[model samples]
Target: MSVTASQVHGAVQTLTQSSDTLFLLLGAIMVFLMHAGFAFLEVGTVRHKNQVNALVKILADFGISALAYFFIGYWVAYGANFFADAQTLSQGNGYELVKFFFLLTFAAAIPAIVSGGIAERARFYPILVATFFTVGLVYPVFEGMIWNGNFGLQAWFESQFGYGFHDFAGSVVVHGVGGWIALVAVLFLGMRKGRIRAGKHTNFAPSNIPFLALGAWILCVGWFGFNVMSAQTLNGISGLVAMNSLMAMVGGIVAALIAGKNDPGFIHNGPLAGLVAICAGSDLMHPIGSLITGAVAGALFVYLFTYLQNKTKIDDVLGVWPLHGVCGAWGGIAAGIFGQTALGGLGGVSFVVQLLGTLVGIGIAVGGALVVYGIINKVSGLRLSEEDEFNGADLAIHKISATSDD
Candidate 1:
């Protein structure tokens, strides 16, 4: 018996769809593991008394984020819903389901980012409610404008600038948005107790360097999947994306090492700064361009994190604003610079459009976070009582510490 042309065609189509699904599923899993990285990073950064709260918040936020995204967020971003029966929903080999899984991980990151900034003092239930609103509505609105071309924003950019805003893998959409929102929440929550005395700031050393380093490592390893898998199809995979990501990582590390004067925390977070900056242009820039972008991001993170914490007296525990907000914004704008043909890049982006889009993202993120967090703060109060703060969030909120002996 010979294989018929129609059978061969059908088999090929099935194989292609199956392969794509598998690829996205793996990508989603890797991105999902980054949440563990987020948790451990916060655990290591905050005081030991607050360690368990960090862990719990990340996990809980993810659960709430999943619910919010499933019922509301996904629809806002992509105009798709899961209200259909299983068979109808499972069309496209259930690629849409896995796609939701992947994107939900990204959506959940907003609260994970805020968790770091507000850690050790935030009220658990209020923050969870804020997370629900952010994931369900705020994030997806901006996400739709950029990724889904909602509201003619992209069209306006293209019409005005001759090229539309181009964020290949969501520098502005995910990291930038998360970072800015975190900043707003941090501002609203105010400084932790005793962090400022006599108009001077105090340093709260990380509880565990090993844990922080471990989290950074996990995030670094998983970022490859995060960037590469944004393609969402096997045929779309690019070695350039992988190489750019590598170069950016090292660039950030080296720059952070120099800028931070060999501080262990900065050294560990350097690669993350680079990865965050390179995320937008990973597919378009030359490796050298990526390195430069990463280096800039590393220096920016070190400088801004220091200034924000000490001089400005903002108590952003994990420096999420510098790492994600600033660096991610840089990634969005850098996509236009390094992605220019003049700079050995693919050259389909416009700097004006990038700037405009980045500004829009920042505005929406800050505004939305302020509104959501402000309402929650007013209604339920966002912070722990001073007694609870001194006692630590782990014991106060969860009735347990990270270690049983504690």
Candidate 2:
């Protein structure tokens, strides 16, 4: 039997759809692996006694976040839900399912980012509650506004300025929101025990450098999927995104190495700071521009992490505010700058629009985090007791340590 043109066309389309679905599925798996990075990063940063709590929290938060996003967050963001029959749900080669899985990884990251800031002292269940509210409501609201164009905010930006706010990926939306929210929770939770005494600061050393390095490496590798896969379809993918991500990562590392004075923690976190900054404009900016953006983000993380921890007395354990929050914001604004035609970029971004969108993201994250965490704090309490603090969160909450001695 001979194949007709119609049959050939149909087969080609099916092949394309299957390929796209597979690509996104791989991306989802890669992003999902970043949670392990989040877990081990927290594990290596906190004291040995609290290591188990850090590990447990990331996994637990991912579980709760999946449910929260499935039931409410996905709907709030895109007005889509899994309420349809299985047949309908599986349409488009189950593209929607894999898409949800991919985006759910991003949604779960909000709580993962917060977990780092509030680690070693936070109550597991209460933080999980906050994560549900944040993933289900707070994050999706802004996500819908920006990515889905739900609220006409992007339209307003385009009308008021030139082009609308452009976050190809989610520098401001994911990292920035998570960071600002984590900052608020950190402030509300107050200093960790013995971190501050007589208005001075005490340093806390990381428990495991190897684990920290491994976590950073995992995140660094996974971030390519995070940034590039945001295109969501094969035709939309670009080598520009890949190159820009690479430039930004090295830029962050180089700057962090210099600014951090060769500190292992800062060096490991440098690539992350750069990648966070580059996510917004990865497709638009030239590699050199991305390098500058990443470099700035790296320096910003180093300086702000130090200032916030020491001078300001904010005990943001993993420096999420600097790495994700501030650097993410910088990434947002940098997109407008480095993405301009004059700056060797693809253009079509307005600096003012970028700033406004970034500010909106910051405001919503801070406000929503305060309300959610604040209520949780007032009602059920957010922190472990001082006794728990002394005994370590692992022993206090989980009844075990990372290692057992007979």
| Per-residue lDDT of candidate 1, residues 1-406 (tens digit) | 9999999999999999999999999999999999999998999999999998999999999999999999999999999999899999888899999999999988998998889888888999999999999999999999999989999999988888898788878889999999999999999888999988887899899999999999999999999999999999999999999999999999999999999999999999999999999989999999999999999999999999999888985889999999999999999999999999999999999988888899999999999998999999989899999999999998899998888873
TM-score of each: 0.99, 0.99
Error of 1 at 133 (Å): 0.6
Residue pairs with backbone atoms closer than 3 Å in model 2 (clashes) = none
Alpha carbon lDDT of each predicted model: 0.94, 0.95
Expressed as tens digits, the lDDT of each residue in 1-406 for candidate 2 is: 9999999999999999998999999999999999999999999999999999999999999999999999999999999999889999998899999999999999999999999999889888999999999999999999999999989998888778868888888999999999999999998888898988787898799999999999999999999999999999999999999999999999999999999999999999999999999999999999999999999999999999989888986899999999999999999999999999999999889898999999999999999988999999999999999999999999999999999796
The number of clashing residue pairs in each candidate reads 0, 0
Question: Which segments of candidate 1 are over 4 A away from where they belong?
Answer: none
